[model samples]
Target: MKNIMNKTATVMAVHRERYELLAENHMFYGKLKTADFYNVNERVEFPTVGDEVEILFNETGDSLITKVLPRKSVFMRQTMGLPDQAVAANFDYVFITMSLNRDFHISKLERYLTVAWQSGGTPVIVLTKADLCEDRGRYLEQIYEAAPGVDVFCISSLTGEGIPEMEHFFAEGRTMVMLGSSGVGKSSFVNTLMGKEEMATGGIREADAQGRHTTTHRQCMFLPKEIVLPSGERIMGGGRIIDTPGMRKLIVSEVEEGLKSSFEDIEELAACCKFSDCTHKSEPGCAIRRALEDGTLSEKRWKTYQDMLREEAFSKERKKAMMKKIGKARKEIKAKRG
Candidate 1:
């Protein structure tokens, strides 16, 4: 946007090639009148919020996303029914939102942490509706013991409590996405940031989609300036936030490393086991079992780790076998051509 004046000041929000572009200065969105110029992942065609792009602003108030700057980081997940899909392009932090009530589960949080680490962005635990919990003191103690070294915050959108603490995330240039299940207040959190409700939120169904049951499809929204300071942490510029569709099923596709770290306690237990391949259940010298009996580790956490590892391995094998079939088909076609 050469004539937009605030080239450096404007915030660009993108959703699949000008499907809906909100120029911080323009305040008007236009369709992709000429998107053939850009490639699939190029500007305009696959625009993601928080993406710094060069645009051609026309007099009609409609504009085109011309170029996308090199992103410092990218966040993505294995799309449902699709082997690979880049849901979000660039983001620095992943604010994994969850409530304190029936939706609370440590295993599911571990599952989200899988893709969070793989996405190249740091994951932060954001507990919504902290006001609902009766014994806040006991809950924090429990979560802290379960997941260490992870930054976790509890907030209430209604009371505007714990919101200022989220300010660390709203820094000028850094980008963060609120990922969580339906009815978990991701939208409510976004509304507080935008100072208005910009996303339509739904309630959780009788059953979740895949994993944590948060965000169906990921979308972007440029947050209205959350800060107005002469000097502070925000260097990226203003700030952009992405709100994803509630995920019913958070099955991880390719984040084995994340799974390992998420269950480091279990991994550490296997080190002193009698058998290198010990399954940790009913084994003679399984350290995991020792921890279980000693009350050092929870049975649910241990089982969940095993189940996630199994799923990751199975996903890898299934993809490999499918690739082999495709390779054989290509060979047959080449032979016929010869």
Candidate 2:
């Protein structure tokens, strides 16, 4: 091992108290410094897959991770009582995969789109299992309606359909993160792209169509420099991809900007309301009300928007309360030390 100090590396996988790192084209194991990360007063940002980090080389054992470098893009989600979880970092595209079978849901797609936009990366909807779905056109229409101005690709990993169209996204230096619920064929998709079974694949329950979690951890995989398709075409660009376990509950927080971007049509209507302070319910000349009544916007879509807004507000309040509690606890600790 080179006797280098403060070397940079990309986090490949994060196990509890351990990390898999790729530095200078070599794979190395790493561990965080307790003083700098674990015993800090301020919250420390833990390194996740796709994160660039500074490390101290250790020829003897695992390298020491000193700091987590700033992220250009990050995907995160938080539950109500738990702390925020960073799913992946430094990704260029979020592949929102949803199978066309029982896994397809417009609301779920919309939710994923909101988080994807908020992550500072382009969101591309990838509808998987095209071979299984008979009414592809209907599902495609629903997707187009739900995600306006977003790119959508319908592909079957089994048959290699629509895989060639996604070749451009695999260009060198680009990184894409796969985001979807369990059983949506994310591993299969990765396997297909790799031209081999790089990740394990699982089947969904036949009765409910709900998928089992084949990928239980988040890890970054480097794409092959050249991938030859079964159809005799070659994908000639190398990139990186981070695959995460399926999130059963994707509770979003601090995604106000993402909401506005995802629901631009609804926001536009609200902007045109006659009263700036209009409640949008009983107010006269309310653009939203008029649109709802005139079939311009579907009621289901409007309800989803309202529900997300409420959820966002609730999450904000919860975070504030949690922070206040932590501050109080810190003050008590300081007093004891004094």
Candidate 3:
């Protein structure tokens, strides 16, 4: 085995213990070093799609990944009965995709925005299946109200409507990660952006309009500089796009900053309350209560914000408890060795 040390590569895909790496335009398979990653006292940061890593390259076989480089941004979600899972890393933008049909829910969008903002990447709302929605004005209005100061694009991947307006985000070297539930047209949007049918498209259930999982794994693809569409239109693309499997559950934890940013209006109102401890429930001089009474803040939005806070608190406690258990296990192992 010819070994080349300290070569850098980007993780393009991950499947359990195996990884597909891209380095200097060449693809190589990689596996983690057990000593460096698995047999450590502290928790190891596993490689994810879009992560830059140091590898001991092998010309004939799987390379040994030595270290995962620091990520500029990481998108993660909590998994029940397991640790927090990293979805993607080092992305510049998070495309929060949702369909305009039955799959669209304002509460879901708000939840996505909170996590997207917390990922250290700018969030851009991508509303897909415009061709299916006859009246999009109301939906757009709701989105604008919920996500002020964030960019939003409404596009139909089938017809290419609103596709041209999103070309600016595809500038060279920028990376975007698609985040949404299944059947949100993420694959279709990727194909359109690539100006070809590179990803498989699946149909949603007619009864509920939920999508089937067509993309099973997370993979990154480099976009060409120029993509010519079938409609004789061309898109200038030079960035990278990571397409991930649809997440069935997106649980947010330790997202205080994200919550504040997503619900800035509510935050500001709370700050204006007469008492810092005011709970907004039958409390005198509660700004939140006043806003609710006057209709400045919709009851539904306020309730969603509160629900997220409760969930976050619960998740944090669970994580703390899990960490304690892990620490105890490590101590027992050390005692045995001694």
Candidate 4:
């Protein structure tokens, strides 16, 4: 029953009924106290990985999580057909890693860009396993065509090629989160950055570029002190990195600014349409339609934008319905009490 409160800490990992937190240069196990449960409107409140929380530790028992601080950003996706659940939080950059081999797909990259933009973090496109791919330039061109104005890098963990360029993002006080499907060499990349095999790596099918998912849980690791870049530049306390288990589906949720940011070119083109409410499907004087017709816009990219818009709309509706159900349930409980 430690009454002292406001012990700020960062959530490193979340497990069933238990949480791992980093506070005051130490790690501690914590559990959510009953009083910490939020009100009805916040029925979904819980600390996800990277959340900064206030806690109180009992010497002879596990720490009690008193509060979950507001998150600067959250990476979440729908789980098991349920509402979106957070995967990580408070990351400054999202490393959207994808292998340059058979796993490369323009549509998948677009989906990741949408989710990264929606997560309120800067998205960096990292094309891994460059050694396996011959025409890196082709994939680079496709990346720019799909996600314009985002930083893109092609790196090989085996040969240390292009690994030095990533050092700029690892400045102190910054955090980066790796996101992609399994077999993208995310762990390998981290190991290369760490100068050792901090994470386990698995073999992938050389044909399809698929591999067994090696990372079983989401965890954060601090970069080594005084990291030396391949360019011979030394940087101290080079930020933090969180490795998450590869996800299969990245279903986006209610994203207005994210959609606009991810598809800025499309939105700008739509602004010039003859009708303010033009859907760009079959409308006359549609700038987007003209762009698609004239090869100014890739049809595949346009379709990806449209698909994300539909998904965002659906997510918004789903959230509204869930909130309605929660409100009704609260009212019923109040009536019963009365």
Candidate 5:
């Protein structure tokens, strides 16, 4: 009983897909028995980062994760309009990592934050490699303007400056995952946490690119000691952190509600427009357009909001199709039983 409690406290995991799990942990995996978690195509379940699971093991300490716990929060994105094809779950915070040197994109940050908000996770901006930046404050200001109510932190793994401040997110039981474009310091941050060169260090290209993709899979690490150092100093540890592969494209799901959060100012302005369905571009008495004309609304921000909504609509259609198919299958099963 004491061992169970201790093991539960140290619940960091390295995930292999359900299929891979079968080959690796056969004795414990067999407890699930008879392909229960597998789909019709023989494909098995995959564990995403940030999943806390129940496991059973033999005396050797080898174990099988028998069941997945109820997730406190999930971050999901459907792949290519396939309703069943979804990924990512149970992240408390989403660190939208971007670089100050060259790999910065306001539109990408906006899109990432909207989806992050919709995923039931707080979004935080991580500006990696501050040593490379001549003026980090200017970059942070631009991000704050693009997405209000989000905390942006800058850190340099090379010099270790600004790194300790990042430990705030690792307080106690909370979990944060970093998602970003290739070569944007996600791996560098992970290396900082491991306190060794555990992760590959990528060099930024002279062509304005930041780094190579060092993290290929989503893996969680356990920080046993609170990084809050005692040398008349503070650092944080004893929480979970998952580093995911660099994602070039993170398509939004049914995140239309998130749009308001992302573009709150636009929505607020639209409410005062003379027309209810004011297409803010050309409509008279359009507050949004007025703002655009007078520099209140940046065209780039507005355009990204519009594109996100369109993609969101497509996601809803896919969900509707999935629901309709499920309904039909249920009806047919009932008729056959009758």
Candidate 6:
């Protein structure tokens, strides 16, 4: 290992085995060291987007990523058969984008809210395509119902409405990431924020209103807002924003506290149940069921909570199974070496 003091860089993007980092006022290509790949016993470690890393700069070749610093926050998901993947790390804000037109749904927003809360980032609901929606008030009401105490904005890329409100959040030294499904106008929102068409955007499918992938991978965009005065003076203050590919499937990983926080009303009601083990399904003295039957709770919201709880439980079990398999494989390798 080289003993030279290396410069610190933040990961801009991760493409397969290669990483792109921004350091020393320039962008450089980097590759992980062999030790970073094999230093862990059972867990797999690799640099991801938004990860701050120490790098040994190379004038003629790719820089060597010497160390990955600790992350303050990470956005990740657990799929059924695949290993858990980190979508973004060390972000301060997570914008859960959803177009207010055909792509709007409270259930999906609830799911995204749980993930965002679990990610250790402040969740802000960005309702894009406000120009296309006929009744913006209706959507705002629904959003407030789904995500109480969270900030929600209805923005129009064509009219530039509600775009200025997000300027403070993107100020220098802060990082934010966008998460939404395809066709939710995430790219369009990014373009409008930057005051130019930086990301290529496509139209939604006529039949299903689904969006084709315009951005193929996760990439970080350095957004520095230029505040222009009436006398032609321009002041610049903005931060980093990362745009991730549209996620079609989002599964929560170890989100028990997130679930409780997101559904605090339901949890509070459940705590008053007569039976500690109440299933909330036709059980006597079940507070959840009582609330559902009365006008206190909506059936739809209750169902969404139950569904997410089940998914979280299933994901934890799958993670346990994967760890067991990895442990067995490592033991087998040691035995073979002996």
Each prediction's whole-model lDDT (CA): 0.67, 0.90, 0.90, 0.84, 0.68, 0.83
Across residues 1-338, which tens digit of lDDT does each residue of candidate 3 receive?
76546799999999878999999989989999889987737688989999999999888999999899999999997888688888999999999999998888999999999999999999999999898999999999889889999999999888888888898888898999999999898988888888777778788789987778888889888887986654668889999999988888789989898999999999999999999988889878999999999999999999999999999999999999998888898999889888
Candidate 2 positional error at 131, Å: 1.0
Relative to the true structure, candidate 2 has a C-alpha RMSD (angstroms) of: 2.0
Q: Is candidate 1 or candidate 4 better by lDDT?
A: 4
Q: After superposition, how far is residue 23 of candidate 1 from its true place, in Å?
A: 8.0
Tens-place lDDT per residue, model 5, 1-338, is 45451111122334454311222323222123235444333344444556545455444545555555566666776666454432456768888888877778888888888878877788988888788899877777778789888888887766667767777787777778877888888877876766656556666577868455666666666554645232224476776677777776887877767787888988899899999988876888989888888998888888888888888788778788877886687678778778
- Candidate 1 error regions (>4 Å): 1-72, 202-217, 226-237, 281-285, 324-338
Best by lDDT: 3
- What local lDDT does model 1 show for residue 197? 58
* C-alpha positional error of residue 287 in candidate 4 after TM-score superposition, expressed in Å: 0.9
TM-score of 2: 0.96
The best-first sequence of candidates by lDDT reads: 3, 2, 4, 6, 5, 1
Instruction: Report the lDDT tens digits of candidate 1 across residue range 1-338.
Output: 24652232122444444444545554655444355543322323244555555666654766665555666655555554444545566788988888876678777787887778777788898998887877667667767765677899988766667767667677667788877766788887776666665766555554652233344445676665643222222222257788876676776777767766667777788888999988766879888888989988888777777788788887777777766776686678778778
Q: Estimate TM-scores for all models.
A: 0.73, 0.96, 0.96, 0.91, 0.79, 0.92
Candidate 2, 80-126: lDDT as tens digits: 67679899999999999999887778999999999999999999999
lDDT minimum window of 10 residues, candidate 4: 228-237
**Model 1 lowest lDDT segment of ten:** 228-237
Please estimate how well model 2 matches the true structure, expressed as its whole-model Cα lDDT: 0.90
